[model samples]
Target: MPSLHEFATWEPLLRLLRTGNAGNLAVPGGHVAGQISHYGWSLPLQRRIPRPGQAAQVEDVQDEFDAVQRVQGALADIGADTISFTAEISPTGRSVLHLISPGPAVEPGIGGPHPGSLILVEDSVPEPWRRLPDPVPGAVPAPSVDLASLERTLRERVPGAVGATEAEIAATEARLGVALPDELKVLYRVTRARWEDWGEDHAVAERVFTAVGCELFPLDDLYIADASSRPCPWRFGAREAVVTPPDAAVQGLVGSPGWIAFGDNGGGDRIAVDLTPGPRGHTGQIIMLSHEDNIGAGLLADSLSQLVLEGRGPGRRGRHGDGPPAVARVNIRSLDSVRAAAHAGLEVLSLGVWEGAPFSLAPVTGLPRLRTLTAYPGTLADPMEIAELTVLEFLELGPEDWRVLVDAGAVPRGLSAAAIEVHGSRHPLQVVALANELLTLWDRPPITRTIVEGHLEPGV
Candidate 1:
């Protein structure tokens, strides 16, 4: 099965899953496209193929990545109304908390699970990716936190970091008017006051004071607020406030009003807290800069405890992969496109909405890497030729389709997963019985998985 990162075609689908901001995302290709939201992914199975020049625009794309770029370009037309791309990326992202502020465009970070990753829809991007030169090998589970235990885990992982002392914490508290949050204070006491490290790309990579993002103050010299300090947040699709003519020595240019700038993710982004509470806001509220839109100093977590829990929560890390070549959904009006794809190294094909289409698989039987084939296979094609596919692993069709393939002794070997939708004239028992009869044809078991409609059945 493909991981969330692998399907470039499903990039928007993946993004919607990662960030629950609802929207429709898909390229013009029939390769992969879907409508998704907080609900679920509903694939746009069929796209009407434009004939000559009947209003539909034709786009030649390399793959899903190219498709996204092309589609974005198309949407970003000058004076384009209602059809504009959003530059707002959610800060509370999936695993990696990307701060999409209006400023410099941040490049996508590398490796597994870290902030600075966001959808290209927003304009504001934080600092570049950061990875320890040689990270200590271990993954900490963050289901719920054990403060002392996590502190010890961090120290053990990065033994070179200098741990903090009680006096150091007390001195810092004295310097800053407000006392540190109990959690923060305890965290500092247990772990290093701040740690510095190098990265493969960044020559002098360092956060405010913590490995998470920003450097702990005093660990790095505190600087007066200036152009070098404040980042210009991209306020596309939003009207986030800015700190024009910022305070000479302000912490965050547009963050909480009476907040202490504790750490930064080295991306000109800060993780701070508002010690002073107002009617609307409360003390100990962990406020951070918005990575998307013009929203500034939004409430990230209610407290430091929430921040810790989110950062280290179990199974919340980002998925990382080199990724395979993204495929596009092609309009299978006829077998011509299918033949072209197979000839051009099409490995997997899902011909949905095949009810009345002129579909046939006979032309592309000998392709080298054509493993998975999904289709209703009736409208204008015979299903028997599917047996010619020697490397079939996954299939989606109806019971009659399976019967045709089986009667002709054309069922592919080692079929692992299949969804055989049974409907129209066929009873559930009849379909189930047919499936069992087909099973008898196999030497052992033909396929590892099989499902009838939405339910599961053994040996499909």
Candidate 2:
């Protein structure tokens, strides 16, 4: 197996990059950048156009595919998650490559050539994820709940279904460290949903799904859908807020310990019995934790009984009101200026690419709830103003902006996590230098860089 640091591992890919982006490489300060992992790669090579009346295929870019697959094989052999590279080639074809390994604390950038993230505080999570559901003192099952009707419906639909034994139910309760809701216990009692019980028949499984109104998990697979179960990167997760309106039927939380995941919605969403309800909600209400969202669950049904019997609940309940937006993005296409996005409720402030003068952060300096701030390179008029945001927990800035904060010893100590936003063809080693500087302030592990010096022939 070729090592990831070997010139042979990256030679083919570098040749392809040089060949495809010849014009870009010939110019002054011109370079090409991309990322690769064991799974796949993000290269800037252009794809060949398909012939008239023909569809494009992998064969259209077979050379690029094969080249990348070779590097991917090396990555797999070396057990490396991901690596980013910056290649600069002269008009005569001489090239210098810089291979950057993002060490342990940083998360790989998504879908592009990014420097990845710098995790400042280890094992630290966002504020919303830390929030637990507010206790509902007098919560009880909804009036529509009918245990007898629900049992009868299940028995009628899945007539020959095998039910769970009392011993099996008790074992599940013990494993979960919480008692099963009465309606849920009744559900498994009618049909244990074991594949072995149905002799691994697909039709029987489908029948159970239809009768149960979801793809039911076996008794042993039941789990608490707590916040920890759904993990999100600090950069994006810190921007979310847990907001449960006064009239909300389900508490808007990252995840609740009371959420007992019993089944799936067939679309990867978890269908759970929410033991923790909102102000106007029933104790054992049905809710759905969307796989795509990280914050809250959607109220699916008032109860498990209501769901199985009627095939639906009181429809989808609104999670947030039309209050002031919690997140704000300032860019050419977004809220033109920071002042327009400023309010007491603002939690996230992001400054994107700007063509005009650099903006000051003074507008939101003293915002009590502001915790996340990410600025695009050169967008900030004064990066030093960030020191005024004493409550920031997550901050992502371009390397230059971060330098301003670091040089003045004003890197917000309250930040639990931070990220370096790399734009264009900045060298990854420089990004790592800035990342290490930030990590050093928090006494966290520094990002290690592996410089694998290699040269490529003009076009191989």
Q: Highest TM-score, which number?
A: 2
Q: Local distance difference test, per candidate?
A: 0.39, 0.86
RMSD of each: 24.5, 2.3
List the lowest-lDDT window of 10 residues for candidate 1: 127-136
| Model 2, runs deviating above 4 Å | 90-95, 313-315, 332-337, 353-357, 455-459
lDDT of 2 at 224: 93
- The C-alpha TM-scores of every prediction are 0.29, 0.93
Model 1 per-residue lDDT tens digits across residues 1-460 = 2222223323343343323322321212112112222222233223346677666544421233343443334323422211111222223321221111111222211111111111222332322111001111232222343466545554554455455677776666666544665556655554444324333223232421334334445422322222223443221111121221111111222433246666654455556654543223345555554344232344555455556544512211111223332122335464335555555355566565543456677766876656556665453277766777776555556666877766777766555334455434232234335544444544322211121111112111
lDDT of 2 by residue, 111-175 (tens): 66565667777888888989999998989899988999999999999998999999999999999
Q: Please report the candidate that would top lDDT against the real structure.
A: 2
